[model samples]
Target: MDQTLTELRTVNVIRYVTPLREGGSMPAIVEADDGFLYVIKFRGAGQGTNALIADLVGGELARALGLKVPELVFIHLDEGFGRSEADEEIQDLLKFSVGLNLGLHYLSGAITFDSTVTQLDPLLASKILWLDCLLTNIDRTCRNTNMLIWNKELWLIDPGASLYFHHNWSNWKEHILTPFALVKNHVLLKQASKLNEADVFCKQLLTTERIESIVALIPTDWLKDEPLFESKEAQRNAYTTFLLTRMQHSDIFIKEANDAREKLI
Candidate 1:
């Protein structure tokens, strides 16, 4: 792990190849100036930039914890991006997303992770389960693992649905200590037998400085229009605080996950 905060490289989208509609956000594969394809998550999607913020924070946090995640980049969509597109819907999508977006490096020849066919060590599974609990990620379910096996390693993807508390920030602080009931639905919950080990290991890695660095990665454009906050900086501070608090009281969710697992097995 680098242990240093490096800004994501910004790449201009040169071509919109095709849309991956498997996700509700409708992220697409597009060719960038660097000649690599990225799955670009549009800001015009239903959840807006909140989804982008979650992707950046959650994905980077996973990387910080020594997990495999595809490289994340800032995809710049010019105003003239989809003018020639015959599909009116796609053109509108391009028009609305004519600014900064989030992209993940396309994993060629990757296969969806199936838990039934492959078994992971209890420690790794516990770590992953702990991560999802800390982020309040509700998308890593049996139906949609949101994980891929590329190069014979498990790679996490599409954390846009994590940090869902931000979607309704009315009482965000209250969520900090709440038990994540959704962990029972997590696909790896059954295999997460070492929550205590994962808790200690993950906390050591996710220091206050690291948490601040991860929250700082959120693009200013994503937070600028947040109506609840007076400025983007304040919004960023809130995210940093939320994550730091969660790390401090990790046992709350860890026990919840353990209980859920006990019920399962």
Candidate 2:
């Protein structure tokens, strides 16, 4: 287990309130010490442990893969909105099954829609796509636009839909491929000298050993006796295996990205 994950377990001062927003999953704004705010998310009712595990593992793995993901921590609360009248209004507003505060990225200036793929740096987009492929992330589509740009650096959010591939891994061939379009033809790709370096980044960052090490940090109690993964060891092994298999196939992705860059000529 990573020591950081070990240290995360010690954060016992979680406060709950009605979420500022809710969407695919419930989300609330939480005020932490040092004026840092985090968006806390809870596992929906009967969704089982998959949602929690996906957030933890997928977030950590993206960090491991040299992508920017929000810092995540596990929190405990004695009571949910079911116990408070103020929280009840939040429940009525969002109707989240579990009580938790989701972190908010307090951005300065104004939030406006970035309308074109060319508006973003292509190399950064390629890196995000590579990390998504490594994790089998399928939610970062054109419609959702999950990537956020702050100070010209790309940060990934809402990875709750990754990892399991939403049970659609077998049909990857039918998926509309978009990363190559941006990488191949976008002008930003021309400016990004480091775009070609992502293959090396992928190799160094997504190693099987590293993936297993992070997976070990998943709290066992949360997954107690879950049938999908018999034990933590099994879960770690499975994730490691998936990474290894994906790495073997990454050459095609890398080659396509390179070929796309070449076509920009």
Top model number, lDDT: 1
Give the Å shift of residue 2 in candidate 1. 3.3
TM-score of 2: 0.68
Task: Give per-model CA RMSD.
Answer: 1.0, 5.6
State how far residue 44 of model 1 sits from its true place (Å): 0.8
Question: In model 1, where do residues sit more than 4 Å from their true spots?
Answer: 224-227
Error (Å) of candidate 1 at residue 136 is: 0.3
Please give each candidate's TM-score: 0.98, 0.68
Question: For model 1, how does the per-residue alpha-carbon lDDT over 49-106 read when each residue is reduced to its tens digit?
Answer: 9999999999999999999999999999999888999988888888899999999999
Backbone clashes counted, model 2: 8
What is the overall TM-score of model 1 with all chains considered together?
Answer: 0.98
lDDT score, candidate 2: 0.54
lDDT of model 2 at residue 75?
Answer: 50
lDDT of 2 by residue, 178-242 (tens): 23333343323333345447666667766666767777766665453535666656755665666
